[model samples]
Structures are given as structure tokens and as C-alpha cells.
Target: MTSTLVENHFRIGKLPHIWCPGCGHGIIMRSIAVAIDELGYDKNDVCVVSGIGCSSRAPGYMDFNTLHTLHGRALAYATGVKMANPDLKVIVITGDGDCAAIGGNHLIHASRRNIDITTVVFNNNIYGMTGGQYSPTTPTGEKGTTAPFGNIDRNFDLCNLAKGAGATYVARSTAYHANMVKQQVKAALENKGFSFVEAVSICPTYYGRKNKKGDAVSMMEYLKNSTVNVKAADKLPKEKLEGKFLVGEFYKSEEPEYTEEYKKIIDSFQKER
Candidate 1:
């Protein structure tokens, strides 16, 4: 199955990715590929966009029409791409820092406009490419190179942020939950309006070592133990839910997609002539 996905979706020459060993970005990237393959999208009809970051490196390895755009500007570029050619399937690959920090304004506005783009966030909780700096999604009290003592700022609940910003679909999964990530990405791709999926990943080299979260296996184990599926979470008592984050689909709704609305205006204007 893995070999089939690689042959169908990945660039063979880019086989060996540069992410540090045990970094979960690879798993998240594979999940995206698997989702695309399962959906059977024509490679040419799919457009993947990314911004500068470790996670952003994924587009170079993917076989789809991809754009490695400027830092925090992937959405802006993707919006133009979708507007110019609404037939394409647009997907954005971004890191926690790239999406929630410098690119945060774009994230919210894209959701506000309900554009037909699927955004998958590879959130390792630190700025892995630039150095082990704390990111917007870095948990409060977690240590990073910049926050050696501990991070004092409150972290953003990205799914909630997207849902509040008007994303038509919102979901969360982890690298440890590879199948779940694939399923969520598939669902996000099918949503017509803006879609957001947060794939919680591990930075074993930096975040793990700095916060003493142990090796890659231990981090994966932590994810397995710490997250509760939203469906089961409702049945569990408050005490059982403490310290456990919720995963699974959080929200979904039907809405007018931004590009389609723009086309409607153009059509109306042409009819008036």
C-alpha cells in the first residue's frame, strides 16, 4: 500500500526527506498523500501550496502541481490560484509557526471568506526549520530555545480559531493517529468551503529534548494516551477528561464558497451586457 501511494503520489527522486529522524512531519506528509490517492484526484488538477518551514518542504516531494510560496503568503497565492481556476483542488501544507504566527492573519481571513481550500497544519509546537523557537501553538509552560525557562503566553486552540473564523470544516488528528489524519484530510478535501485540519506532530529533536518528553516512541505514546476522540469524550466524566485533548472532527457546515460567489457576480455582470 505504501509503495503504491509513493508511485502514485510522490516524487521518486525526493524519496529521502530531510526531516530529522523521529520527527513526525514525514508521517503527516504521507497521510496527506494517502488521502489524495484514496480520493483519486487527477494529479494535474490538484494544487498544493506551502510556506517556508520544515512542513512546507512537503510540496517539493509531492507529485501534484505545487507552489512553495513566501512565508505566510501561501493562502494568498492559493486564493488567486483557486479564483483563476476554480476547477483545481487546492491544498495548503503549513507548519504551526508558519500558519499560526506570521501567517495567522491570512489563516483567519481565508476562513472568513470560506474559500474552497483544504489547509493541513503540521503542528510540531516549535519553529523547527529556523531553530527550536516557541510557536503560537506551543503549549503554555513548555520550554523552547527562546523560552528556555518556559513559555508564558497562552497557546491558540487552532481548530476553535478556524471554526470561529467560519471554516466550513474543522478537524484535529495526530501523527500517532496516521489513519485518522488520512481520513480527516479526505473529509477536508470534500468540503466545498474553507477546511482546516490540525495534525499534531512531534519535534523529537527540539521540542522533545527541550521539554524532556523523551524519545520519539515516548512522544508517540504520550499522544496516544493524552488525546480522547470527541465522540467518546462526551460520554466520559470531567475527571476522566482532564489533561486529555480532544481529537476527531470538531465542526462541519455547508456554505457559499468564495470563488463561486465571485463567479456569480461576474456572470451577473456579463448577463447585463
Candidate 2:
């Protein structure tokens, strides 16, 4: 618990997280912890809420006040938590399946309402936890247990979805770029309105080998090559953009967050009383 990411913010007995040997969840978790530390959040002031999935296990491993909630309902719980205690920093960590599949409606409405919660989605393309299955965000042409012939369905463009839903901050990063992930998370925390971050992850056991992508290490390599920051990538040609994802902060704006705005209404009511 003494690494740069674990600096003075971790609680005891949460060490030795239980991710797979080649799993990317651990890397993203480290990024989150580091971001929280950089943002000067105390363990008591931050709450990590998660839905049922491998990513949901993240909160159990963190030292903060955490909530392991129902499947695909992390956003709903996070919205309630933020509304109840506007001063607390609420972070939602959910798997792609849990967030984009079962919990998709909540995700959209949460963004539309501009809740003050920060959402981090661990997207491994395929569902790694409840067996290797297909999630809504699974990339087209990727093979999963359910999609033996390869997935023909379209995948979500998470940044665009968030921006369209009215989130004030939206960004994307992968496990390969751990440093930038932490940086973006910190920025998301500082933003007043709803924030969404998509953390591209690798499931070596389920997603990597099945798709002939080799082990987890190789999957991370794929992420390293498949993504480009818009600022640096715009100079490249259309061919350069082919099959590559645009990362970095895609959008950010100043807007009224829902919870605090509701608090202002209550304050006005108190004055009238």
C-alpha cells in the first residue's frame, strides 16, 4: 500500500486484489486510486459504488466507503448517494455489460440529469465475469462465447453517448496508458457536472485467447496501438484513423450538476419557511 497510487489514501486489509493474472481491472483500479489521491480525497470523503460484475469487485478492494449494489444499477444508486449527501464524492465503477447492457437506461438518464457522480466503465469488449459473453459495448467482429461466428452487432461509442446524454465531462483511456487514465479521472473529479470515463480493459482469459489476440499482455499491446488522442491524432490522415479509437478528453463544459442544484432549491425553500 505504499506505491504512488497507494499513497496515504488506502485502508488496511484491502490489499492483494483478486483480479485474474492478466486482467486489466487491477490496472484501472490503481489508476482510480491514484487519481483520488491526486485530487486530495480522503478515504472517508469518497464513496465507490459498483454493480454486479468483475468490475464491481473493485469497491470491495478499495479502502473508501464503498457500495456493492444490484446488477446494472450502479448509476441509480450513485445518483441517490450523491443526492442524499451532496458533499460526498461518488464514483461509479461498472463493467461494460453491467453498465451498457442491463443498466443502459440508468446510464443515459443519469447523464441527462447531469448528476455529480463520476462514472468509470471497464469495457473489456466481451463480458468476462459471468462467463465470456457478449455485451452491448462488445466491438463488432469480436468473437465471444455467445458469438462463435463473431459479433455482427454494433458497439457503443461511449464518449459520444455521454456527450449526447448531456454529461459535462467525457473521456476515454485504456489500461495500456495508465498514467493518462489517472490524469483523466482526476479531471473528471474536478468537473462539476456528470462525468463519464471509459477505461478500455483486456480479458486475457476470456476475450484475448478466444479472439486469437494472445494473452492479456498482448491485449494491452492492442490497446496501445489501437488508440490515439484527438489532439495528437487529428494531424493524421483518414487512413490513420481506421480501426483506431480516439481517446483523451472528448468534451468538457461548465454546467449545473443535479444534486447541488436540487440543494439550492431546498435552500430557497428554507429561506421562505
RMSD of each: 1.1, 1.5
lDDT (C-alpha, whole model) for all candidates: 0.95, 0.89
Please state the error at residue 227 of candidate 2 in Å: 1.1
Task: Provide TM-scores for the models.
Answer: 0.98, 0.96
Please write out the lDDT profile of model 1 over residues 152-179, one tens digit for every residue.
Answer: 9999999999999999999999999999
Steric collisions counted per model? 0, 0
Model 1 residue 188 distance off true place after TM-score fit, in angstroms? 0.6
At residue 158, give the lDDT of candidate 2. 80
Candidate 1 Cα errors over 4 Å, as ranges: none
- Residue-by-residue lDDT tens digits, candidate 2, 119-171: 99998888887788888887899889999999999999888988999999999
RMSD in angstroms between candidate 1 and the native structure over all alpha carbons: 1.1
What lDDT, from 0 to 1, does candidate 1 have? 0.95
